[model samples]
Target: MTRLISALLLFALACASAAVARPNILIIVADDLGWADVGYHGSTIATPNIDRLCREGVELNRHYVSPVCTPTRIGLLTGRYWSRFGNTGPNNERCLPWETETLATALRSRGYDTCITGKWHLGSLPEWGPRQFGFTHSHGSLAGGVNPLNHFYKHGKYMKTWHRNDRLIEEEGHATDLIAREAIRYIRMERDGPFFVYVPFTAVHTPFLEEKRYLEAVKHIPDDRRFFAACLVHLDEKIGEIIKAVDDSGQRDNTLILFFSDNGGQNPSSDDSRRYPDTKPTSKFKGMNTPLRGWKVQTYEGGMRVPAFVNWPGTLKPGRSDALLSVTDWMPTLCALTGFKPTANLKWDGRNIWPMIRDPSKANRDRTLYCKGPGGRTRMVINDGWKLIEIKNGERFELYHLDDDPNEERDLFHSEPDEVDKMKRILARERKADDDARPDPKRKNPSPV
Candidate 1:
């Protein structure tokens, strides 16, 4: 009996040690947030909470993502380029194969409790929701940004996109508040093992409808940017709330918190207020990606390169890393960080960047990055600091050595024909694998590659 008791105690200790080794991953993604939107980035908008995280964590100065929401999300979850799935734009159809291995699936397989509590735009319908992609629990818009109060996607069948665990439901409070609340609740919940919480806030996206208090908080900003500022302030506070939940749960040091925007913020555009119900805004919407070349949906630095950071108290040191990275790296990096070894080839396009996060000096290595925009027209590839943007798939090509001119003002295509030719070869090689899962009009769902 004494021997059996000793064996049980040893088992308990082993379990505790394993739990300690597996850190809780909390990825907080802001929708349509610009590179200059956060306080640490020198934006006028007050993002005290985001600033605190950037200051305390490893600020990723050159992190890249797709130019749009759907592509970025797909790249993040799958650790592969969205174009590989034939997705270069915002998609409402089911993008992934039925058997795709996602970040959530990989983590969950390792006994991590996975949950996504915000926009899951990979598929708009309930049948093609986050749970289908391996999330154990899901809440918030199944589509893109919804009506703030009404919780509708747009004027269509998937408009009523609000749900919890893929079952459509309705709630009252603002989306930013609801998402943060759910994330915090998940963080504070009593669970057996480590938790992976993805809080993708639909804040500062579109149809800016912030509460009076939040609006009043940023009243000093111009009218064009006032609403966005208000929404950002609200988002910043909610992010702080979620972080505080982790601290309160005594899991701050045990949690790896990653914060980044889905894409670069857009310039002012006509407010498509008619798409949603009860929205009164008819003026232009505005977002700033100051000092960067382009806005959202373009292949330029401002569009793909976004604000990002990783905060893990005591584990990751606070500093800035200008290493060229992509949102696709999240899956491989996080999985590697949590000690997950894939049984098979997951076909990951992303490389494990944890070593870079651990020691910044080790980050500077030659790597190639690819980005394909909507409609298969615009494509870009970055190799050894040479950035190439193919407009209309080669009707015109713009080349910029980012190491020399990060703003992309000078076009070196004519002067550096060899570089352009090399980049074009890279683009062709990458594009060959695209459109593998594009939607078929005759069928309900496209076949997976």
Candidate 2:
């Protein structure tokens, strides 16, 4: 009877050990999605699945990113500001350096099957692709974004669509649909082990190519905003599909899903009037950054602020966090969640947001959030409730008290000179830290623009 009890105890321990294993991670990133584009954020777009994630998880209201895609991608992958690596250049290929450590590489070291699907705007260099960056399986465009219809690469060059494991495969559906399908397939195939699936959808970006079915569904919304809303809905459906796949695989309880946008939306003026005033308003291309000033490509809150949500069925309780977090926080946060120790020598500008996810009320991340605009021409820093903006070659400084003036209309540079100086000193110290860590002096530029 003692031997029988010993055997039963051993079986119970084994089961418990299996249950305590690290959970699977799914990071779904939407390209150019606005702060209010998702349903939970007060948009009319039918994003039920994404909304569900927000409802059942933690919605990060004060999440921010780079003004554009490439820099934000670099920060999200490396857990450091892209400027530290000289990746703040305007071009997409210049953002993701070849030697930098990525989340995939870090997770792969801990026995997680890392896979990336959809846009890889980091670099198109053969050696810098996702497969080379530690993702075992990668399938998507190598450029910043793509043309959904022609499957074109950067500069309108046609490249063969990719497939599982970097294989050149042809896809018949929209780019978003193809990405979603592959994500579902990967989840089903790797349900047994801990996996990291990075689904960075190239939806609602540029080259507005909407599926006819989605367009037809939103015909009643008028032509101008119809395609935009439909694209959002399509993305929402794809999100639903992936969520269902995770549930169907019986890993729902052991999976952690994060949803967020890479950056703000692109606002193309009608008839390119902003570029050529003679032309009429042809197409009204604008992102819904309603209450915030400016849009994409600017150093304003509307350009950097993005919607972020984290959902882990059994781990994180449903709630909303106003804790100021940035894309740079993801790497360290994920490492903490998965019990992986980050490299001792690797200095990071972002702190782990794991505590915020676990208990939103307990988070105390009040550090300064810095952002560099295109070509590093414009720079801004948000510390406490004040935002200090410095435009390239501009003599005057623009400061906004976010608590009182969230829209950034009231410039308090002169009114609050003391606060501005305090933030400037902090910003200077942070920039020096970044400059000191650089391996190459030529790559380090204090003035971004």
Candidate 3:
């Protein structure tokens, strides 16, 4: 950790001496993408573009996010655990408060053109959409996952979440293609300075729809697996196109491209499928996060631990960081990299991890990573190598030494009573209980669909 701090200081000194050009930022988030789904993670799904990044970029091997969409998005934008806001589930209601500063708004203040071209589940309505909160140009689904071709939000009041800017609109194309093209168009648009593009693709989430080409490509796979594989291929190809666009714009050298999942993949049989109204009736959908226990909405590794990498050709050194990185770290980290001083009251729980990313050994694993499952029903805290998980009303507790039991197979509740007590106390201190969200109906039943 001392080495990491020293590296951070040295980097700061270098930046102070040199006039480094502000780099363009591209953050791509895939919904419900499994930890092992990408080619870099040994999945057979063709993700050559993503795999390329892993080979030449700083792969974040221990990145953690919330178990679901809204919380993860909240943390990424606010640099604070979403639990502090009190809502955990999908947050279908008003999510971010008006006073909150988003990643786009922060970068926009630094003369960067900001745009978002994908899912915006922060608040599931046009009135509470991306334009109202930082993104200068916004398009695609404003709600959670939507019907890929139909562009509907799972048949609800905000079913028509598809839009351009803050107004509803209909565009004829695959959602993935449309999002990638919008991002490409945004990159090509004449702008005065650097840009921040946030593309949160709604693919691999639900309502599993794929075009004929992708379907035919993955035809060898059976049933839902084939459909899921096609979705991955579509997403991967679109990502390749977006990266090409950045390269064509001559921003490749300075652009910082980040790719990660919003949360772990969903296992329909183990998950509350009821929430996914548009999902088709397949025997058992293919979303693999093997060697990890539990699915989304649970305080398990499979739910929060996800795939992430940062590729900046001239800046970050290519390597892997097993450090405890979180979705909340981006805001502060970017602020540090771009020299954006935040307001006094914007208290952030995440620290600048520039040095840590450059070298994995600088990982300060002692920092507590607090996680609150959907509905505040489940809570988790990991400090150092020990972890503690507790069910709110169920009055259940599970403890594990993550260093020795990364799979969380052996519960140390009784074997390591002292460790359990210590972690429980730590969790008590970290749990920020708040109740400002819509009720999560899916928590009671795993297969809602």
Candidate 4:
């Protein structure tokens, strides 16, 4: 009888240990946030909460994503490059197959409760939302960035994109506030297992609408950038709220929180607000990648390399690293960290970067990173420290050693014929894998960039 009691106690303790070992994962993604947008990155925008996390976490100074939102999200969730799905730009169609295994699904299989409360742009319809891809609970815009107050996407059948779980529901609040509210609610919920909370805020994205209170906070900024600054302030505050919720829940020590932007900032453009209901007349929407070349749509350092960091109270020490990491790496890294073993090969283009994140001293050199721009007009490959930008299948090429010219200002293609040949071969190899999943006969050289 005593032996039986001892065995039962040992089993209970083992179960408890397993639960504690698997930390709760919280990933917060900002839409269209730029490299120079965060307070730590020398932006004038007040991001106290984001800065605090950076100060308390490991900053990924060289982290990369796709040049656009949809591809970045696809890479993040699937642990593979968006080009694998033949996606180079944002699309309204379903991006994933029904049998796809996502970060949420992998974590859920390990007894973690997965929830996402913000932009689910991978698929616009309710049937194709986060739940279909393994999220147990999902809320916020199913489409891309929406009008801040009205919570509507661009004028179309998918305009009403807000939802909970698998159904679209009407809500009455600012989009940022609503998303944070749902995330905070989920964090505060009573549960038996660890949770995976993905909060992809739709702040600072488009239409440039912001609350007056946040606007007042950034009153010192110029008129052209005041609303954008206000959006940053609002986003920062909500991030603080969600972090506080985790702290209040006594899960701060047992939760790992990651924050990053989907892609780079956009230049002043009214293209996103076309045909939207009751929108103000076309005005400049401020976007800044400052000191980095290119905007949101190009595969330059400015477009793909946005702000990113990881925070866990006693786990990840505060520091900055220039390790070459991609957005797709999060799935494999987080799954490995939380003990979620994949049953089969997930065909991830990204490597597990936890080693580099845990210790900034460990550099990720010799890893190749590839990016294909919209319509396949431009392609970039970074191997070692050299970067090659090929336009329309070598019709025009720009090469730079990022170790020296991180801004990509110097064109070394004509100077180094040998390096250009080597990079072209590498780029060609990477391109061969593109469009294999969904073959596009028009994947050939797109229009000139």
lDDT of 2 by residue, 189-276 (tens): 9434599999999887755667688878767665777767788888899999999999999989989898888887666562222222
User: Over the stretch 60-119, how does candidate 1's per-residue lDDT look in tens digits?
Assistant: 989999988999999999899998888889988888777778999999988999999999
Residue 317 in model 3: lDDT: 74
Model 3, 427-449: lDDT tens per residue?
87776344443335333322211
lDDT of 2 at 188: 88
Model 2 RMSD in Å is: 5.6
TM-score of each predicted structure versus truth: 0.93, 0.87, 0.91, 0.92
TM-score order of candidates, top first: 1, 4, 3, 2
The Cα error of candidate 3 at residue 271, in Å, is 7.9
Q: After superposition, which runs of candidate 4 have C-alpha atoms over 4 Å from their true positions?
A: 1-20, 281-285, 439-449
- How would you encode candidate 4's per-residue C-alpha lDDT over 1-449 as one tens digit per residue? 99999999999999866643789899999988999988888988889999999999999989999989899998999888899888999887788776678998899888989999999888798877888788989999999888878888888898889899869898899999999999999999999999999999998787667767988999888887787788888889999999999999999998998999999989776355665666663336566898999889888899999999998888778899888999989998888877777888888888889889889989877899999988898999999899999898668999999999999899899999999899889998998887656634333322211
The better-scoring model by lDDT among 2 and 3 is 3
- List clashing residue pairs in candidate 1: none
User: Which runs of model 1 end up more than 4 angstroms from their true locations?
Assistant: 1-20, 437-449
